[model samples]
Target: MNRTKLTPLDAAFVQLESPGVPMHVAGLMIFEPPAKGGADFVRTLVSDWRKETRIAAPWNQKLESPSRWQLAPCLKTCQDPDLEYHLRHLVLPKPGGQVELGQLVARLHSQPMDMRKLLWECYVIEGLAENRFAIYMKFHHSIVDGISASVLLMKGLSDSAKDRKTSPFWIQTAPEKPFQPASFKMPSVPAMLGAANNVLKLFGRSDSLTTLRSAPRTPLNGPIGAQRRFATQNFDMTRLKATAKTAGVSLNDVVLCLVGGTLRKYLQGITALPTESLTAAVPMSLRAEGDLSPGNSVGMIYSIIGTNVADPVLRLKKISQATNVAKQQVLGLEPEMRVPYSIASFAPAIARMLTGVSGKKKPMFNAVVSNVPGGRDDKYLRGARLLHCYPANIVFPGMATSFTCYSHAGTLNVGITACRDTVPSMQKLALGMEEALCELEHGLGLEAHANPRSLDVVEAAL
Candidate 1:
């Protein structure tokens, strides 16, 4: 059997899975029909996909044992995967716009994937008003992190629109390497002692920037229901870059500040704004350059998102400072120690979840915000133009909100997923994000672009 064991970090995702929280990450992609294709384009694509019953690695693999924390599930390649079960064809109702698309995604994302089969599913959706089709595919976090999954998705696409022979993402194959177990190794005695000391210093520090208990209690930190509400907002990459340049910070810093400002506005609107700043758990990819192998390679950093500050420019400065401090602390550690440090830092929260004390204790962070890079140039699948790709990520038990953004083809696409009951009118937050961006630009004395190029038509249709 071609088998691979899940790493402790990856296995934790399996352990944390429950009826309320589904530990899966997904991508929602909108594609324009090719010039030569007719009204039956998406149907033809589905027919071609269903004809190929042979599945590929990862997608064709299932758990060796049930994924309980006690059983420690390992993945073994299976001979057959039910194509009909893994792939589905759906049609959007009436409006066929982003609003309707988001509604459909929220419902689909709320349902958990059956662990007995492959831990992935893809939906080919047609009937979009503008004649565009959409694809929503999700994979368990144990199989791939955001970067690795993005690489796999990109592999199924071509930079040239004229390239019509591109294969589907699942069937792409790589040169087989000898199977080395994916389990985490116990560190050497000396390394173990060093890691212990490092963890203590990382968590024991009293500095406001480095302390683990710096997160503020907000409405966003609470027990969540099974249902989820998802919203998306698009931004012009050029305007964002200009803001980053003016502030002398990275684009991610600008994004953090924008989200921070939006959260402040939303909370104030609901009369639940926290007096102190809220901390965010920012995810950092630990994958080596060009290392697109499947499975998780992620670490976490805590940043003060500057929610307490009302001035957008100053808020961005504080966020940038906090992020830089957190990055420096992580960079100070050896590459091998970084992941362990992150796990250690997050241990308290995980313990709370396991002990059924999740929402009763202080949160490690108020929310999660992740930024993933996508293809800078336009992408095409069998000559169909790729418009935008938005990411939907996991929200933990205590932290009920997650914001994941993807930058593709000169646009920054933001996806907001939250507990449906706790976060009301989720679209308000999405609109607030747009307002925050404009506010930031105005505060920086720069002109803000009206709207992202790709979202104009979609918004009009909505």
Candidate 2:
């Protein structure tokens, strides 16, 4: 049996979890019905998954922390795990449309994972309209970050559609070395001094302090209820790339502009637009050199969304500048020091959890925006064509909404998760995103010349 202690960053995610806040990251993958379709097909797949008696190292492990001295929890592998307990099969209610499936997923996401067992669960949903099925899987933040999860998923899927016998991620053995706790050694005096110097340098930076300051209070920055609403829409990658080319900015800048414009429109509709622009905590992957081990290895950088700016072109310019500044700040830090600096940047979030602050209070940022790059090739699962994969992320105490962007097979899928009470109509925000993109295209003078295929795909999906 393998066992390893969680890093401070990983443990922090666990400690931050509360009944109202479930600190798990989930994904919704829709697949076309298999060639040999029937209720029996699902049962057979579950049986195949169950036949593997031995649970994988990380999947089989459960967290254990006995005393205050043990701040980091250890993952102790279970000898035998009940596959049926972790993998579930469900049928959507009649007229199993996207609306019904979304409702079920939101409800499932509201509930916390059973920590008494492993820190993950998977649900196979059937009865979707259009001969489609879906898989909703969630993992505790401590288990896998966005990049690692993407890597794991790609490893499980096949690049060629002809390959149908490939096993799912859970049943496959880990490709990298088994996880082992790093050997503990007391730091030398010089090493300690160096760390101290880095800490002082990090805090001395102006941008670091700005990240700590409270963001402008808006309706979205309020207390969040347990209920969640998830909305998804896909954009044509070719169209976005063309827009980026015309604007002379990165694809990410184009995305941020879209989000900024959408947020401005949505908040304006409700008469809650803030005078100052909204800021988002953008997560950056911090994978060490040649390190492909699975676990959380990420840092955060705060970026202004340029919501205060009215013109679409001006908003894009402002967002580009803000993102460039944030990246420069991150680049200035030593690789080893980035994690510490990242943890320090979350001072406001940690404080909110500790003080039980009301949602009405201003937040450190308006939301968390993440962009996880996916494989470019089309993927298939057991002869079933993969339609779309949308990310569903967690919402913290003060932050009512979060956005996750994943690009796959020439499509950019944007998933928005929010507290139902705070953001009652997430569909409005989703529609706003499309409108924002169209505005950008028009502003850049690409509306007349750009290929209509990209916009057509988006319109069809929505």
Candidate 3:
């Protein structure tokens, strides 16, 4: 196959990647044994996956110039990658549970990928309790964002539990479309006038761009080490939806509120909580519906999460108001201007990461909070019921933590990835999230819901 040039954004991901910051995104999926359970269920699946010698696009693609931390000219397909090297099998140590699983994922996420080969790996991990095993797959972010990566991982599953003929994800071909810039459209005269009016009004608002000149320098924004800490939390969709309905806000608004409250509590415990409300750099996807072209296509918006407010209900209102204004600013811009606006919005943060001045200066935002959609149905792989799928993403210099969540099968799965050393006892954030949710419910005069299990083991093992 002919070599294809990497998009500028994709190349930037590769060029900026380092041992301290591996630019890859991963999904951890735990599965229940088939109705006719067998001890070798995961082993058999791994053996079957090994036999599929043929590989597909993106999985088969690699940097043309194979050099770590160096710019690559193009991406070329490797006709055959060593299947044994790419597909791995492992077992958790004694008392295999959430603590063990989180530790293993953090270790794996910290290791950089081999640039000379295809940029992906699949692991079949066994030995969890309750006769359940897991499949963890990671792909370089240069090739796929969290949404696209989730799509690829779930594409090879079956909706029916009885179906046992599902193929491995790597063998399936990706959509053939290449990355194309969004078409530029000339704004109508009235629309342009309206945008100008909105800009004028935004200057008077407290959550305006002027307010976003710099983020509060909290412990979360700092240089990171090679090691990481991964934590998972899940919530029932019914309760969150009901809360959103009762509060007359979008589900996302409630989610940001939950995040704000969680961070507020955690920071206060450390006595490092900034006096000012923190800002979050939220990722907004640029891909239109049905645009499955591979590579990164996302924008950014900064929202002020009301950390200063002690009242949960009031905090939610402040966050919703800030986020609405930020969204309006982005949506008000013309199509062509949106990308530039996003770039400018994040340029300072990117500069900090590159120049190694991350914690030394004010951050662009305190953290990155991203939300992606996972399918609504229970999916299975060869009749193995997919129970939980949690995301594990990257944490670059300055941004010590990332909160990425996806809704799957009537639940919301949140993955908190952080620098192990920088954010000590990171699992506290997981437990904090639960407490914050309940607090919000009570503040709204709603009955508290049962909290989902999130592996609240003792402090993290070194």
lDDT over C-alpha atoms for residue 38 of model 2: 69
Worst 10 residues of 1 by lDDT: 453-462
lDDT of each: 0.82, 0.76, 0.81
Q: If both were scored by TM-score, which would come out higher, candidate 2 or candidate 3?
A: 3
For model 2, the local distance difference test gives 0.76
Candidate 3 residue 449 Cα shift, in angstroms, is 1.1
Report the C-alpha lDDT of model 2 over 1-462, residue by residue, as the tens digit: 567888877776777777788888888888886666665666566667767775565667777652223457778778678777888889887557766777788898888887778878889888887768888888888878887766666666777767857685675544464455796566566655554564454334354332535368888887789889887778888989998898888998888888888899989988999898888888887775555566887777777888999888888987888788767665655545556666665544665675678475667788888999887888887767777888999897678899899989898888789998998777777777888888888888877333342342343234
Report the backbone clash tally of model 1: 0
Residue by residue across 1-462, what tens digits does model 1's lDDT show?
798888877887778787788889899999998998887888889888888866678778878765556546688898777888888999987548877888899988898878778888999998887789999999888888888778778877899989977667788753233455687676667766666775676555445464567877888887888988888888889989999999999999999998898899988987888888888888898775666787887878888888889999999999898888888767766666777777776677667777778777777789889999887899998899999898988876779989999999998999999888888678777877887888899999998766753353334323
What lDDT does candidate 2 reach at residue 25? Answer: 88
Q: Quote the lDDT for 395 in model 1.
A: 78
Candidate 1 local Cα displacement, residue 249, angstroms: 0.8
What residue pairs clash in candidate 3, if any at all?
none
Candidate 1 ranges beyond 4 A from true positions: 69-71, 174-198, 201-210, 452-462
**What is the C-alpha lDDT profile of model 3 across 1-462, one tens digit per residue?**
768888767777787777778888999998988978577778888888899888788788988776645655589988888988999999997458898898899999889988777889998999888878988898888899877788788877889998887788887777755666887677677666655554444324353452445478898887778999999889999989988888888888788888889899889988999888888888888776687767888867778777888998898888888778778777877765566565555555665666778766667678888889878899998898888899988888778999999889998999999998998888888887787789999999999985847445435522
